[model samples]
Target: MQIILCESAEQVGRRAADIIEARVRQGPAVLGLATGGSPASTYAELIRRHREEGLRFGDVTAFTLDEYAGLPADHPQSYHSTIRREFVDHVDLDLAKLHTPRGDAEDLVAEAARYDLAIVGAGGIDVQLLGIGANGHIGFNEPTSSLRSRTRVKTLAVATRTANARFFEGDDEEVPKLCLTQGLGTIGESRQAVLVALGSAKAAAVQAMVEGPVSAFCPGSVLQLHPRATIVLDPGAASQLTMLEYYRDAQALNDGLQ
Candidate 1:
C-alpha cells in the first residue's frame, strides 16, 4: 500500500484529482465511485476541472459502490441523487454509461448480478475510489463481513446506521436498514484503488488500514493486498501512523526517482 500525506483536505483532493485525470487521459476510465463526506472535496475538484480546464467526462464510465436499499433513486440521501447533484450533472458524462445498483429492485439478487457483470464487461474498474467508515468499513462492507462475498444487500450494523444518521436528519431509525454494496472481493479486483480520508476522527481507521493486520474487522485493510492502492490522507487523518515522516519522504524520493 502507498500512502500520500497531504497538508489538508483540499490538497488531498487536488492530488487525487491529478491522479484520476492522468488515468482518464490514458483511456476511457472505468471508475468505481464512493459517496459521503470524504469524497465531497474530491468531487468538487473534479467539477472544477471540468468547468475551468476542459476536463471532460464524456468517455468515463462510472459505477457507484453502494446505495441504501429501498430508498427511491430520487431521494435526497440516495447515492444516485448525491452523485448527480455533486458530479454527474456538473460534467458531460454519458448518461447511459453511469450505473448504480438498483436500490428498489424487486429482484435484488439478479440486479446485483447484472451490476457485477456490467463492471466486469467494462474490463473491470481502472480506479476504484473509496471512503472508510469510522468503524473501518468500506463500501458498506461492515465489520465481520465475508471477504470473498459478492455484490448483495447488507444489513447495516448499528454503528453504521448511527454514523450515517447525520444525513437523515439525525434520526437513526430513519436510516435504511440495508444497502447494496460490492463485496470486498469485488472491490479488490480493480486494477487500482484510491482511498481518501481526512480529519482526526479518521485517524484510528487510517492507522488500522495501513498499519494493522489484515482482518475482516477492518474491511479497509483489504487495500493492503492490492498491487496498486493509494491511501491519500491529510495530516489529521495520518496522526496515528508511526514513521509517517519517513514514509512521506520516501514517497517524495520515489517520485523524484521516477
Candidate 2:
C-alpha cells in the first residue's frame, strides 16, 4: 500500500490520472471504474486530458464498480448514465467494451454472476479505481460485507442513502435501497487498485482504510490485502492518518527516486 498525500483535491486527481495514463499506455488495459463524489475530480482530470492532451481510450475495456438497483440504465442517477455523462461520453472508446452490472435486469442474481464471469473472461481488471464511503464502505459493500464475497446485490446503509441524497434532490427516501457492487474479493483480483479521497469529511474513513486493522467492520480496510493498492489523498483527507509526516517523506523519497 502506498499513501500519496497531495496539496489539494485537484492535485490528487492529477496524481491518480498520472497512474491511469501510465497503465493505459502499457498495453490493452482493463479498467475498473467507480462513481460518487470521491472520483468526480479524477474523472474530470481524465476528461481534461482527453480533450487537451489527446489521451485516448480506444484500447481500454471499462467496468463500473456498482449500479443502483431498480434504476433504469438511462436514468439520470443511474451509474451507467452517470459514467457516460461524466466520463465515457467524453472519451473515444468503443461503447460495446464498457460494462456495468444490470441494475434493472429481470434476473439480477444471474446477471451479477454473469458480470463476474465476464470480468474474469476479460482477464480481470488491470487497475481498479475506488472511493471510500463516509462510513468506510467501498462500492456498496456495506459494513460486515463478506470479505470474500463476489459480485452480488447489497442493501444500502442509511448513511449511504443520506450521503447519496444530493443526487435525488436532497431526498434520501428517493435513493435506491439496493445495489449491485463488485465485492471485496472481486476488487482484490485486480492487478492494481487506486483509491482517491479528498476533504476533511473523508479523514476518518481514509485513516481506517489505510491504517486500521483488516476487518469487515470497515469494508474499505480490505484494500490492505491487495498486492498493489494506492491510497491517494489530499491533506484534508490524510489529516487523520497517524503517520502523515512519514507518508509525506516517503512520497518525496519515491518521487526523488524517479
Candidate 3:
C-alpha cells in the first residue's frame, strides 16, 4: 500500500484525477467507482479535468461499486442519480458503457452477476476508486462481510444508515436497509486502486485501514493486500497514523521537482 498525504482535499482530488486520466489514456479503462461525501471532491476534480484539460472518457467504461437497494433510481439520494449529476453528465462517456446495479430490479442477484460479468469481460478494472466509511466499510460491504465475497445484496449497518441519513431528509429511518456492492475480492482485481479520505472524522478509520491487522472488523484494511493501492489522505485524516510523516517525505521525494 502506498500512502499519499496531500496538502488539502483539492490536491488529493487532483492527484486522484491525474492517476485516473493516465489510466483511461492507456486503453478501454474499466473503473470501479464509489459514492458518498468522501469522493465528492474527487468527482469535482474529474469534472474540472473533463472541462478544461480535454480529458475524454469516450473509451472508458464504469461500474459503480454499490447502490441502495429499493431506492428509486431518480431519487436525489440515490447513488445512480449522484453519478449522473456528478460524473456521467459532465463527461462524454458512452451511456452504454456506464453500469449501475439496478436498485429496483426484480432479480437483484442477476443484476449483480451481470455487473460482475461486465467487469470480467472488460479485462478487470484499470482503477478502482474507493471511500472508507466512518465504520470502515468500503462499497457498502459493511464490517464482518467476507473478503472473498462477490457482488451481492447486503444489509446496511446501523452506522452506515446513520451516516447516510444526512442525504435522506435527515431521517435515519429513510435510509435503505440493504444495498448491492462489489466485494473485496472484486476490488482486489483492479489493476490499481485509490482510496481517499479527508477530515478529522476519518482519522481513526484511516489509521485502522493503514496500520491495523487485516480483519473483517475494518473492511478498508483489505486494501493493504492489493498489489497496487494508493491511500490519499489530508493531514486531518492522517493524524492517527504513526508513519504518516515518513510517507509524506517519501511522496515529496518521489514527486521531486514537480
Candidate 4:
C-alpha cells in the first residue's frame, strides 16, 4: 500500500488523472470506475486532458463499481447517468465497452452473477478507482460486509443513505435503500487499486483505513491486502493518519528510485 498526500483536492485530481492517462496508454486496459462528488474533479481533469493534450480512451473498457438497485439507468441519480454526465459522455471510448451492474434486473441474483462473470471474462480490472465512504465503505459494501463477498445486492447503511441525501434534493427518504455493488474481494482482484478522499470530514475513516486494523468494521482497510493499492488524498483528508510522515518519506524514496 502507498499513501500520497497532495496540497489541494485539485492537485490530487491532476495526479490521479496522470496515473489514469498512463494506464490508458498501455494498450487496452480494463478500468474499475466509481461515482460520487469525490471523483468529479478527477473526471474533469481527465476530460480536460482528452480535449487539450489529445488523451484518448478508445481501447479502454470501463466498469462502474456500483448502482442503486431500483433506479433506472436513465434516472438522474443513477450511477449510470452520473458517470455519463461526468466522464463517459465526454470521452471517445466505445459505448458498447462500458459496463455497470443491472440495477433493475428481474432476477437480481442472476444479474449479480452475470456481472461477476463479465468482469472475469474481460480479464479482470487493471486499475480500479475508488472513493471511500465516510463510514469506511467502498462501493456499497457497508460495515460488516464479507471480505470474500462477490457481486451482490446490499442494504445501504443509514449513514450512507444520509450522506447521499444531498443528491436527492436533501431528502434522505428519496435515496435508494438498496444497491448492487462489487465486493471487497472483487475490488482487490484488480491489478491496481487507487482510492481518493478529501476534506476533514473523511479524515477519521481515512485514518482507520490506513493505520487501523484490517477488519470489516472499516471495509476500505481491506485495501491493505491488495498487492498494489494506493491511497491518494488532500492534506485535510490525510490529517488523521498517524504515520503520515513515514508515508511521505517512503514516497520520497520511491521517487528517487524511479
lDDT of each: 0.90, 0.93, 0.88, 0.91
| Candidate 2: 10-residue stretch with minimal lDDT | 86-95
Give the top-scoring candidate (lDDT): 2
Quote each prediction's TM-score.
Answer: 0.97, 0.98, 0.96, 0.98
- Cα deviation in Å at residue 29, candidate 3? 1.0
Query: Which residue pairs in candidate 1 collide?
Result: none
The lowest-lDDT stretch of 10 consecutive residues in candidate 1 is: 144-153
Candidate 4, 1-258: lDDT as tens digits? 888889998988987887888899889999999999778879999999999999999999999999998888889999988899899999898889999987888887888889998999999999999999999999999999998889998999999999999999999999999899999889989999989998999999999999999999999999999999988899989998898779999989986897
State how far residue 163 of model 1 sits from its true place (Å). 1.5
Per-residue CA lDDT of model 2 for 130-213, tens digit only, reads: 999888999899999999999999999999999999999999999999999999999999999999998899899889888899
Model 2 TM-score on a 0 to 1 scale: 0.98
Q: Which ten residues in a row have the lowest lDDT in candidate 3?
A: 249-258
Residue 158 in model 3: shift from native, Å?
0.7
Off by over 4 Å in 1: none
RMSD of 4: 0.8
Pairs of residues clashing in candidate 4: none
Ordered by lDDT, highest first, the candidates read 2, 4, 1, 3
Q: Summarize candidate 1's per-residue lDDT along 1-258 as a digit string, tens digits.
A: 888889989999997888888888787889989999998889999999999998988889999999899987889999999899888899999878989998999987888888888889999999999999888999999998887877888899999999889989999999999999999999999999999999999899999999999989999998899999999999999999997978889889877997
